[model samples]
Target: MSQLMSIDTFLDSEEVLVDVRTPSEFLKAHIPKALNIPLLTDQERAEVGTLYRHKGKEKAVLKGLDLVGPKMSDIVRSFLEVAPKRTVRLYCWRGGQRSQSVAWLLEQAGFKAKILKDGYKSFRRWVLNHFEREYQFRVLGGYTGVGKSDLLQILENKGAQVLDLEKEAHHRGSAFGGIGLPKQPSTQHYENKLAMRLRAFDMRLPIWLEDESRLVGKCAVPEFLFQQISRAQLFVVCRTIEERIVRLCQLYGVEQKQSLIDACMRIKKRLGLEHTKKAISLIEAGLLDEATLIILKYYDKKYQYSIDKRVVSLYLNGSEMSDVQLAERLLNR
Candidate 1:
């Protein structure tokens, strides 16, 4: 006899959260920091699902048992190794057989195991609902190379709530975005991360975020999130084109030459072949300043297009001062 619980019931509890869904499903999105102790492998789960659809529940249960029998001891060992408290909360796709069966097994092994009332699907619903709520977002908008990411970090250090979308997405929102970073999370996982971050913030205070397109690398910002940011207070960080170009070079100059050239080539159609060739040549020749200048012109136009589309609330001149000075001004406001 196990207790059925909602995700919120134990999300911050001392009990360990174990996702009993298959690894692939867990990888796409699971409760943040939840351990994956799958009740079935991807192939096994598929087989069970097919059997359930065509044959019947009895056949599927039998097959699932067969697949899980040999792994029972291993599962127990893994669960205990990770959960020192001897209490575990389990969930699968929809609080279905997989999670129930795991709960039974864990309980039999002398660990207190509870199942989520509606499982991971329920958690996902909670996540989506978070975005649907109205929020007062303090947006930090700027052209490319305005050091917005650095400023967001500064704001965070000063106790302001800041969501670094680029950092979370492991991208800088450009062709050169992936130059030196880990692989970005799947869109599903990215949203999961965002939902977690959203809950952590105090809604009474303004939440700071960088203005971004719907897309960041391979990850797309959820529609409700994009909508709120669009409607929120929008402020631009103004910087000189020359300064932006210099900043771009500082950021990308240490990157490998081939990486820079590949990034340029990625936008060849937009850059035009002649400009692309010139940019690549300059980068290869170690004249990174000249190379970045050409790329900045293209980026500046693209950013201006974004600006033109938005109803900007204010534009803060940050070119003449250090990021720290700019951060102080924004904080006072």
Candidate 2:
């Protein structure tokens, strides 16, 4: 049997990753390019945790064994179905009991299975470390509704290097951002897509990307890319509130009036019910300008607050430049 390998080693190999974490945990987040094949159901894991805390370790282990014993054949079959024919690497939360058990089973069945040394935890740590390190990046920061995506498209059209993070994640990255958008890709798919894009870029020139959170919809940015964005120089696009609202309306389409209202309602607690009510009334009255003013004051402030927290160095408000000039400057910079 081959010795267990560290996540970094496993990452470099041409092997398929078998993630044995709970589905919910996998859904919330996971290592980039990892495929999930949970050894325990969400409820089963919860039951085991409760038993461990309230009962005892022995009792929890016994219960876990009881649950897994009957399902062993089914689990093995399921894993084989998705696993590649070549080398296979397996991991759970830690490289402790679950992954070891699975790897042992595979080895006994005459299949080569390499266990991850520190499991998913180690891979997550690696990701965080890589992200915290410095990397060169060019950020696209713009006020809400400034058509940053359009600008990205224009840049791409002009043959400039770009990474459309939102497009890769299949999310627009806002509260009402998901409306009219396709279902977001899995984190694994997001990383695969992003990797391809990164490979396509000329390493000599800096990469350009929009400012985004670590998680976009259901997908997560890979650790290295996330870190790169965090340290990268920023360029802000500024536009008038009215102009922004017009751009947003165009992006979302006028048919999303209800989505807009529902989004406003969801934030009622933060914006205050009175303010939300006024915003809703403006929308209902077909006074888009009035509704936009309220939303801009409220939502725009939130956007600015997030920007303040991130604190990237270079800032350019798009309100001052024409779109063509902005595109040229972004490409040249």
User: Best lDDT goes to which candidate?
Assistant: 1
Per-prediction TM-score: 0.95, 0.70
Alpha-carbon shift of residue 209 in model 1 (angstroms): 0.7
- Global lDDT scores for all candidate models: 0.88, 0.76
Maximum-TM-score candidate = 1
The segments of candidate 2 whose C-alpha lies over 4 angstroms from its true place after superposition are 46-65, 84-86, 153-205, 211-232, 238-243, 254-256, 266-278, 285-290, 297-325
- Residue-level lDDT of model 2, residues 34-142, one tens digit each, is 7888889999999999999999999999999999999888877877777747357888888888888777767765668888888777866665454343445788887
Candidate 1 residue-wise lDDT, 200-240, digit = tens:
88888888889888999899999978988888888899998
List clashing residue pairs in candidate 1.
none
Q: Candidate 1 has what TM-score? A: 0.95
How does candidate 2 fare on TM-score? Answer: 0.70
* Backbone clash numbers for all candidates listed: 0, 4
